[model samples]
Target chain A: MGDYFVLAISSIFINNILLAQYLGNCPFLGTSKKMETAVGMGMAVIFVLVMAGIITWITNTFFLVKFDLEYLRTVVFILVIASLVQFVEMFLKKSIPALYAGLGIFLPLITTNCAVMGVCLILVNEEYNFMQALVASFCYAVGFALALILFAGVRERILLARVPTPLQDTSIALVTAGILSLTFFAFKGMV
Target chain B: MAKSLTQEFVKGLWDEVPPFRLVLGLCPTLAVTKAVENGIGMGVATTFVLVFSNILISSMRNVIPSKVRIASFIVIIATFVTIAELLMQAYTYPLFKKLGIFIPLIVVNCIILGRAEAFASKRGVFRSFLDGLGIGIGFTLSLVALAAVRELLGTGSLTFWVKPIQILGPSFKPFSFMVEAPGAFVALGLMLCIMNLAGRK
Candidate 1:
């Protein structure tokens, strides 16, 4: 449907999880040192966020909502994410060693990465149904991936730019993030 | 043993601080720190969960296998986060509603889990407690500072319990952006720069 495309575009630029919502910024500022690593991390995050959203949606709608144990949502969701990350790591390692080699380190890190969990929370809060949740997760993951890659590219450029020692690493990253966030603010008018 | 325990405890406050120094827990630090009150509330709640969970995890570290340590640590941390959520609801209903989902989202807060795996799992119970306390206080202090600057700049008047605590009163107008998202980044970035400069000195 046109609605799904709209959702994807809008979420990716306008309602961006990092620049707009300020979620999952740890990787944005921390892991964006190199473009290749950023690309790898972004793809890894995309897979994790979509899978997390889907699994959490199913778990919430069927188990938490039906059983009236909605209070356990946080506990259950975290456990699921951790296990899911583990499963993915093993699966990728066995099936596609090259892909695994690229994403392997980031996989363990993604388990605790707030972005994956944050997307699931957003889907639940937005009250997206199973199908909508899937679409939203896919869009949101892509958005996060896009933001990561963009920042990584910028940071790679930044590395060559003669910078002061004090503002070298995290400070420069934060300033860059602030600028990106301001740019993303322009998307507020789109939706 | 004792000196290292002190080192672990002190590190969280300054050297290994969650938000400002280490930049670990960015989500809550930026999101909930719109106001001084919210920041303090979130900081204390997170500290409670972090300290307690660190204690429990450190004590049980020997039993949990290396292969499944991370999963077990998360479950343990989640249990405490749940308890903290319930306590917040029971005692501070108004604050609970204000905090909303962030309370539960504490389950995934990297600071707590990072401490569990990095320090607590390898340390003894008493030292873990001390480390947790130090880190928790440090996190709380940073949140309070960020919230204070944001609240003072954004609101024109800081408030607690619906009463305005005036610093400059009606004579001063607030810069609303300080209460917004970009303001969080600007203020934190500036503060980080200042702090790093001071540390170098």
Candidate 2:
């Protein structure tokens, strides 16, 4: 229980997927212009990340490791993520049209989001058991969501305060994200 | 024909240069560029995957159905990425470990996939190869520049393969922050701002 708690806290705060680990940054910068879009993308990422994590773990253990086809992990994992994103897109479009509309193009974009692939690779590298892999995956996604939402709030505020010409748009957002990442360092010793 | 091929190659240098002008593949650009070696390693690995995948995809563009083209492109990209990963592990163990997950994460690097869909699928095989090489080299140069600034400021030194060259004397105190995660963003952000300013004039 303590170990799981530590894992959760560390992954969410110290090893933040967006701020520290540098995964899932394309969406972090792109979708963060609006708070609503950020939240929607975050939720979609969490859902897919957790599901892909578990599925990849099962495949890694049963198929890749069994056959000593570790080299195939990258190819296989990406195929899984691509197909999984497609499935989620179709399912959401049918079952929850409103949410699908909210997510819009970002849902399809999640197929290439590095955070999802990064989590799968990290869990495999750490050699986590099934339970630990699930927990770590969940924590990483939570961290991604936490950072994305927080950055979205910052960006929304920055929309009004930008005084410079060259430093507007992505330039300002990158600098703001840098400062946010700096703040995340304060949690380094927590775990 | 030769002129157009050169055009495809030269365009990626500045006009469509990624992670800066194009803003694609920022993840690896920010993550592995702390050291110049890692930057080059990641860049070359990406170039290998990009060039080959682009060529292969261009050649196969006719056979793949349009509806599932994205999926097919991904599978092809992932295969090349796996090859790059395995080759790196076999030849460059230290750099491979330093790059770590970012290497495999190249499968998701927007530049590779973006090129395949936007350029490779529509162009001929030779043109796609040039596009990939140009973009890959541009990415490498950008990474090296970023890594150089970060290393010099963060550690007061720079290194390629051998011993670190001391850029600052013992009296100089490294900023340290320039080498960390925040520094990567701040540095790249400032660089982009400068690039923006320069581009206007």
Candidate 3:
């Protein structure tokens, strides 16, 4: 239990998927303009990430290893992720129109997002067993969502906050991300 | 024809600018920028794959129908990535060891796919080749910059030509953090911010 908590917290802050690890910076800086959109995109990412993790784990263990086809891992994993995103897109569009609207285009974009692929690769690197891989994937997704939402919340405030014209957009956001990343480093000793 | 090819080449250098402006190919950019040597290795490997894949995809663009272009592109990109992986393993074995999974992770880099779909699919073969070369070099330059900063600060020394040319000062003591993950974030974020500032005024 303690170990699990350590992994979870460390993953959230110290090994943060966005700020620290830089796995998901595209959306971290891209879709973070609005709080609502960021949260929606975060949720969409969490969904894909968790699923990608599980599916990739299965494929790696069962197919890649068994068939001695490790070279095919990238192609197979990406195809799984792309198809899964498509399915999720359709499902979300049908069942939860409002949520889908919030996520919308970002859902499709998740197919190419490095964060999802990074998690899968990390899991493979860590050599996590099936259960641990799933847990790690979930933890990674939650961490990703947490970082995105936090950055979005801060960016939302920054947008309204009076700041210099030159540092308004990307500059300010980057500095904020840098500070956030440094803040996350405090969690290192905890783990 | 020559002019159009030149446009594709120049566009990737400035307009597309994979890492800074477009934000594609984040994994390798953030992963291997710890050492200048690692950065160059990753950059060259990626360039070879990108250039070749772009050339092949553009040449065969018409052969592949629109509906399956994405899949075809992936296959083509994956093939070159495999070739890159094998070559790296064969010659630059140590750098390959350092890069580890990232060498394979290059397959999922969105920059490759984005180019295949956005530029390669529409452009002619010669133009696509040039696009790949320009974008690849641009990417390599960006990684070099990122790695230079990270290596200088993180380790306080920079080493080029990994083997057959060992060079580290007696006072060298690595900061260690610069080579770690967080340093990647700091280096890339600062680089991007600086680039944005420069482009502004």
Top-lDDT candidate index: 2
Candidate 2 wrongly placed segments (more than 4 Å): B1-3
Q: lDDT tens digits, residues B1-201, model 2?
A: 346778899988888888899988999999987888888898899999999999999999999999999999999998888888889899989888889999889999999999999989998899899999999999999999999999999999887864688889999999989999999999999999988998988
* TM-score per model (chain B): 0.94, 0.97, 0.91
lDDT of 1 by residue, A135-167 (tens): 899998889989899888898899889977666
lDDT of 3 by residue, B24-62 (tens): 787788878878898899999999999999989988987
CAPRI class assigned to model 2: high
- When 1 and 2 are scored with lDDT, the better candidate is 2
Residue-level lDDT of model 2, residues A29-129, one tens digit each, is 99999999899999888888999999999999999999999889998999988888888889989999988887757878898999999999899999999
Error of 2 at B33 (Å): 1.0
Prediction 3: B-chain TM-score: 0.91
DockQ of 2: 0.88
Q: Across all candidates, what is each one's fraction of true contacts kept? A: 0.51, 0.83, 0.33
Residue-by-residue lDDT tens digits, candidate 1, B1-201? 446767878888888787877778888888888777888889999999989999999999999999888888889989998998889899989888887777887877889988898889998899999999999999999988888888899987665543657776787888987786777777777778777788886
In candidate 1, position A40 carries an lDDT of: 91
User: Model 1 - which docking category?
Assistant: medium
The interface RMSD values of the models, given in order, are 1.3, 0.6, 2.5
Of the true interface contacts, the fraction found in model 3 is 0.33
